[model samples]
Target chain A: MTHTQQQNEHLWQLMFEKVAGVISTKDLHYLEAQLREDESMQEAFHAIQISFGHEDLERLKEDEDWIDILSVIKTRPRTTHQHRFGKYTVAAVLAGLLVSSAGLYFLTNRKTTPPLAAVTAGESPQAVVLQLADSKTVLLSDKTTNIRLGDVQLHNAADQLTFSSPDNFSVYGGQHTLIVPVAKSYRVTLSDGTAVWLNADTRLQFPFSFNGSSREITLLSGEAFIEVAPDAGQPFIVHTPNSTVQVLGTAFNINAYNPKQVRLSLVSGSVKMNTHGAAVVVKPGMEAVYTPPEGLYTQSFDEKTVLSWKAGKHFFDKASLSDICLILYRHMGIKAVIDSSLRRHDIHFNGMVDKHKPIQEFMDDVKNMTGVDYYFDAQGILHFR
Target chain B: MKRKVEQHNDKQLLRRLRTGDPNALNDAYRQYRVWLLVVATTYLTDEAEAKTLVEDFFIECWDKNLFKDVRVPLRTFLFKTLTERCKKQGIQINMYP
Candidate 1:
């Protein structure tokens, strides 16, 4: 091929990549620059665009206009129909109440509950513990059997607890707290059919059976990915330290490890987050962060990075040394102490730590990459120098 | 004759638009939205962002009272303004030959 022909082929390749939504930013800029200066290149790009225009038009037609353009320009109420949530009547009603009340229900439950001393760090339990409403605590492991509490039966199979309640109209049978200690994770299915995957060093409290207009659960601490069962009559509400997330029927991950902020990433469907007096609705692929003083705000998030813990891996993107140590302590139950000399310097890491792999593999990788040496002291604490 | 008739209608629409007539804005959107959207998507390669650009173009035209000083035909003016906006976003389309 001639040099010009080869350049044309390269330009066409870039155009195709652009249309496929996989063009790197640098190549896109180069292609745009060529299209700007060369009329023939402009014609070629337009031809490529027109070839896909019909399908693009069809897709655009099928998309519901979430914002009414004309009404917004006219300074009128841009009441676009929320067709996605139309089937959930109670969700629609609660959404309306959320707009009008500015989170009155959330504010009423703002009193902070004291942290459970039993699950505190440095004294972390080795196995999962379930505290029943009768103040009876049961240690859970792989060989545990079923436990009955009132009309509900906790079926223990391996690392998961599935609740089977025969009656649906039972009154509030009292709250049960599930504590997952460091170096472990557990899954629990609430009586309302909501499945919650508890992460390490996590605490979750839920009732035996939901009998009211809303199914309420408290994420006392740590992280959890919850898949809520669709119940139009009773909206599922999750209470964290700094905020409350109201879900009609959705799956989302809530990270409340930092006591100052609660990060809730919505996987599917919509959720309303209420913090202090501010309320924001979070859509799928978006995260709502609530911190005291800063309040609540929503931003786009990467799904693979935010929800990687469910797959038994923790991904770090330019995380500080101190942060990595905290994560190690949280996931591996090994107290990581950085030497004072190493702590003064700004050292960051980019890697993944697998829960299934031995901690030494990760330590070796870190040491090889950054020349940071680590050893377990006499007290079983990890020390980095 | 058909071209002249369109030019006359365009003048009337421009007059109403400059006077802040909502019907004129609605008529303009109904008449030109699809063509403008096609032009925008061709450059942006993102359907959502393209729709926003088109919508924002019309809204900004109204907000800035840009129709009052239109020396060219309304269609040409709209096309030229939208092309400039797309150019600002780093994609350039060939104007009328």
Candidate 2:
């Protein structure tokens, strides 16, 4: 390379390093001087900064189809992801970026990445299904499933469904529910960018996009950990049969599988839980248990134990036998019965349940560890004696 | 024939984008935003942060004209930019390495 080319490369490298937040102030002048004289240097510097955020950039870059994702969605306009600005404004900004000869070259010269192909039969698990507003049942059996509803798009990949939008489709708004069957869990990204990790037997109802002041969803049943997208103008609300939770923005978990006692655990941010017209606000690291007649109460909970399902594992500090059996039944479709002989065992045990393993294996491991002998009855009921 | 057609389409889109057409950029964003978020989340673990970072990257892409003389694909360029940025931030991408 020539001397000028070498100098420019060194300058680009320095500016790129600065994007990663590594350069000192002294190095700033050299970068600034180059950037001011050469517009491409500035563009390159900014591009590098935005692309390399931390470790995640590498994984995204390696994905060949990452660029064509928008192209695929263009075929179906309504399904949109997070769009803070309207299409025109977004385009104007992007146009400004592309106007730079350097930026234009960067965008066009590269090979066009292929769009994600539809999930074939063998690529996905067959258990989950999507019940659309039109009552059209779409089976999600592949590793990734993409469905288009008018202008709205739904992409389900690896147990997660992300709702996104197409450019021409202005406001793709509607209501939809995701039902996760027993012995399974799924994650979803709502139109507003709120992420919900739904546990087994969870039916979550949400809109295709938030049009109103409050973004509300019904947790018909089961457990979910929610990370609400921050929009002070809109409050994120979750409704259950017995309780309703309201928060501006935050990450929290709600276990409302039981109609009687609805558990709301906040990991960060604050949530206002209302049960039977009685309200209580829960702070970070705190939990609120709402029972209709008894009202809502607050207490500290083990974060690891409460959030362990995200890792496909369940942990208990001193969990009771009945409670554990109920949990197992709920998660593994196991019919666990405690024989009258062992009813009073009151087996309070500490253990971990690996959801990936077969229910029988977990049962045997627990039985041996607790010395609580168990056998399958004539009816296939697991009886603990 | 299909490859040539796609190449023609890509070139057309790039030409429009170079003339400061917002639709082209918007189209690109719509297509790749989620994938970018997915990649961001793998490292940040926080959806909000990942989204914000990706958005910032897009804006920068607009303002800096980082796409000049693009030899690599746009997606590859963005990925390359993201990795280099992360490296400077002292983030280790590969756990095994």
For residues A1-385, could you state the per-residue lDDT of candidate 1 as single tens digits?
A: 1125335535654654465443567889998987777664565455456445456544544324524556766564222332221321111111111011000000000012212454673576567877666544555655434544445656666689887676663532678888898888899988888999999999899987887789999999999999999998999999998789999999999999986989999999989998889999999999999888877888999999888888888998887778888889788777898887674456678899998899999989888877788889999889889
Give residue A221's error in model 1 in angstroms: 0.7
- Ten consecutive residues with minimal summed lDDT in candidate 1 chain A? A101-110
A-chain TM-score per prediction? 0.67, 0.62
Residue B49 CA error for candidate 1 (Å)?
68
lDDT (10s digit) by residue, model 2, range A228-320: 999999999999988889998899999988889899999999899987878999999999998778777999999998999988888867777
Docking class of 1: incorrect
Using DockQ as the measure, the top candidate is 2
Candidate 1 matches the true fold with a TM-score of 0.54
**What's the DockQ of model 1?**
0.03
Ten contiguous residues minimizing lDDT sum, candidate 2 chain A = A103-112
Q: How close to the true structure is residue B87 of candidate 1, measured as C-alpha lDDT?
A: 48
